[model samples]
Target chain A: MDSMMMGAMTQSMKSMPDMAAMDMSVLQACMDACAACEQACTVCSTQMMDCSPACMNCADMAGTMMRSMLRMQGMTAASMMAMLDACIAMCQTCMDECMQHADHSDACRMCAQACKDCMDACMAVKDMMMASA
Target chain B: MDSMMMGAMTQSMKSMPDMAAMDMSVLQACMDACAACEQACTVCSTQMMDCSPACMNCADMAGTMMRSMLRMQGMTAASMMAMLDACIAMCQTCMDECMQHADHSDACRMCAQACKDCMDACMAVKDMMMASA
Candidate 1:
């Protein structure tokens, strides 16, 4: 999520016709959100709450979604859309599961917030892609 | 993962009707392969070759795939199959890219092999699911 990595990713994206026109700022925001969600979910998962499994799933999906954006050359627009949808679904599931325990566990509360942010970010990306298309 | 973590994951899966009859050994082997593939791809990604992006993508996908298996309660059979297919495709892309430089780079060679193993493990899981379905 640093400038240097973003610069490298931007450079890489130039080679893909569908990705060349993407707004770097939007992509960066989504990546940052994904990273934050992944970290939050990871911590939440370690708490061994009932939501742990959903947290684990969301964490991994967020991480993968972030990496896929970083490596756009390995993706087509269709594939990217599918991945974003999956990430969004996973985040929603995790957020719903974590919200149940949010009252008693600070970790779940924070994780749920992270999942919400990530879902919103992913949706923004999807919207951008749709508009561009 | 260690036995304790696996035991916990197995206990968790018992609650999911679709996953109740899963063979833990097969799932364990797939998880091990995914872990190894993730590590190898992470190392290979740092090399900054043409395959670096693909390696990063592969590493994340493999990690996600493994975690999804660990948290089967969050996944349905349809979603799991789609994820497995995506992981296998990512691994194939990474393997193809890494194999290009395998002759000169041990990291690429090992990463390529790891990708192959991960792909095979994912396919085995898919086959198991299909057989049971």
Candidate 2:
């Protein structure tokens, strides 16, 4: 997210008490991770491997997680946590599935890496929220 | 998704144990609902209301849900259920938030309606899975 968009979002989200104190950098990192993971998974799914379904599911979940972060005004700490947990689970599942073909498929390898990155990013957000709380 | 794409998907997913038995019509309806909800939420987010965040989140979730349905080869019954539950929760939250301003905003009203429809469509898929299981 750009500063201009972030400015607009922050301004619009003044009604949310928790959002006011949220770290934009942490949120932005997670969004970026989600976007990357979604792209990787999309490409991996095209390979028609056994992991294709998991890749597709991860891609969607990651995209949703990114968008949710972008629209933080709609989130409570609890909702955010739940969403993060779900994202992490989906990523982990995808990564596990993709890793099975990592040696045979470059796309699966890359997708697995992306899922790991996304999981780490989501965990970071969860950690930040916990610390803040 | 078109019949051609659906055909391709079904062909590619032949390796999945359960996907062979899945009903395309039920999955297609859910995908359509998800796509509609995503669009409605995207438009609603542009309104910059308090619900914008939730709308954005819902939009992403709905899109992801739709795509997951399209790529059913990667899904297991358990993962599908988890994804559906998360999607339902996100839609319910978005609907609740959007309904608050429905009287003043057509976008919000449409978004809320879309969320409700998506929720119902997802529930139908769940019910179908349960009946089959």
Candidate 3:
């Protein structure tokens, strides 16, 4: 996310006292990871491999996770937590499926790594939320 | 999706014996609803209303749900059910938020209607799954 967008987000979120305290840089990292993972999974899904379905699912979930972070005004801590958990589960599933085909396909290998990175980034946000709570 | 894409989807899922019993038309309707809801939510989110966050979340979940159906080869009945439940919940939340501004915003009204229609379509698929299971 750009500084200008972050400033706009901060302005828009001023009403939410809870979100006002959010670390913009951390959130930005997570969102970027989600976007990257979504793209990787999207490319991997077109491969027509057995992992395609998982890749598609991961792509969708990652995109949602990224967008949700962008729209923090609509979320409660509970809803955010649930969404993060779902994203993590979807990434794990996708990573596992992609790993099976990693040796045969470079796309799957890169996608699996992306999924792992996204899951880690999401976990960091979850940890931050928990600590703040 | 058009008839050509539907035909292609059918060809791709030939390996899935369980999906062979699936009704393509019903699935098509559900996917269409999801796609429409996603588009509506995406537009609504950019409106920067209180509903924007929910709209963004709905857009992501709806898109994911639609793509997952397209890649049915990757899902089990259980995973499909979970995803449908998540999508329905997200749509209901978005619709509720958008309805709050329906009197003032045409976009919100349209997005709310799309969410409702998507929820109905998803429920129909769930009912079909239950019957088949």
Candidate 4:
């Protein structure tokens, strides 16, 4: 997610037809959101609460989402849409679970925020996909 | 992937409709493969080969595919199939690139093997999904 790596990723993504006309910033934001959400969710999952299962699921999904952005070539329009739907579902579930304990846990609060951000970013990608399609 | 964590994950998974009848062994094997392939792909990515992009991509797709399994609440039959296709595409691309230098690098060979195993495991999941569907 550093500037150099981001630059490298952008340079690589320019080759894709659908992405060629899309803004790199949107992709970058989604990736950043994913990384942040993954970290937050990971920390939260270690809490071992009733919400832990959802947290663990969210953490893994966010990590996967981040990596998918990092490797866009392997993603097609359909896969991307499916992934976005999955991520959104995961973030919603995680956020709801985390919110139950967010009042007592800073990690859960931060995780909820990260999940929200990730959901927003994923929605953005979905919108872009729709527009392009 | 620990016994405790795996146990928790397994217990959570048993609640899913399609997964309720699955041989947990098959899912466990697939998860283990995904974890191993993710690690291998992550390490392989740092090598920055012509394969690096594919490595990075495959690693992410594998991670996503694994996490989706973890978050079964968020996945449907179609999403799972799309994910398997993407993971297979990624591993194929990564293995092809890595094989170019497999004669000189153990990591590449190991990576190729991991990719192969992941692909096989993913295909197994796909086959299972088809049968279940």
Residue-wise C-alpha lDDT for candidate 3, range B40-99, written one tens digit per residue: 999999896688889988888888889889988776666677677777878888898899
DockQ of each: 0.34, 0.45, 0.39, 0.23
Estimate, for each residue in A1-133, the C-alpha lDDT of model 1 and write its tens digit. Answer: 7899989888988887988888999999999999999999999999965888789888888988987887788676766776787788788888988999999999999999999999999999989999888
- Per-prediction backbone clash count: 0, 2, 0, 0
CAPRI verdict on model 4? incorrect
Q: What TM-score goes with each of the models?
A: 0.77, 0.78, 0.77, 0.68
Q: What is the lDDT of residue A4 in candidate 4?
A: 88
What Cα-based lDDT does every candidate model obtain?
0.87, 0.84, 0.86, 0.78
Q: Give lDDT tens digits, candidate 1, residues B45-94.
A: 99965888888888888888887887788776666776787788888888
How would you class the docking of model 2?
acceptable
The C-alpha interface RMSD of every prediction is 2.4, 1.8, 2.1, 4.4
- Regions of candidate 4 where Cα sits further than 4 Å from its true position: A1-9, A15-18, A67-86, A99-110, B1-18, B39-48, B63-86, B92-113, B129-133
What would the per-residue lDDT of candidate 2 be over residues B5-101, giving only the tens digit for each residue?
Answer: 7778777667667666668788888888999999999999999668887888888778877877776766667778877887888888899998999
Q: How far in Å is the alpha carbon of B56 misplaced in model 1?
A: 2.3
Candidates ranked by lDDT? 1, 3, 2, 4
List, residue by residue over A37-93, the lDDT tens digit for candidate 4.
989888887885566767777777778778777777645566567667767777887
Looking at model 3 chain A, report the run of 10 residues with the lowest lDDT sum.
A74-83
Evaluated at residue A92, the lDDT of candidate 2 is 84
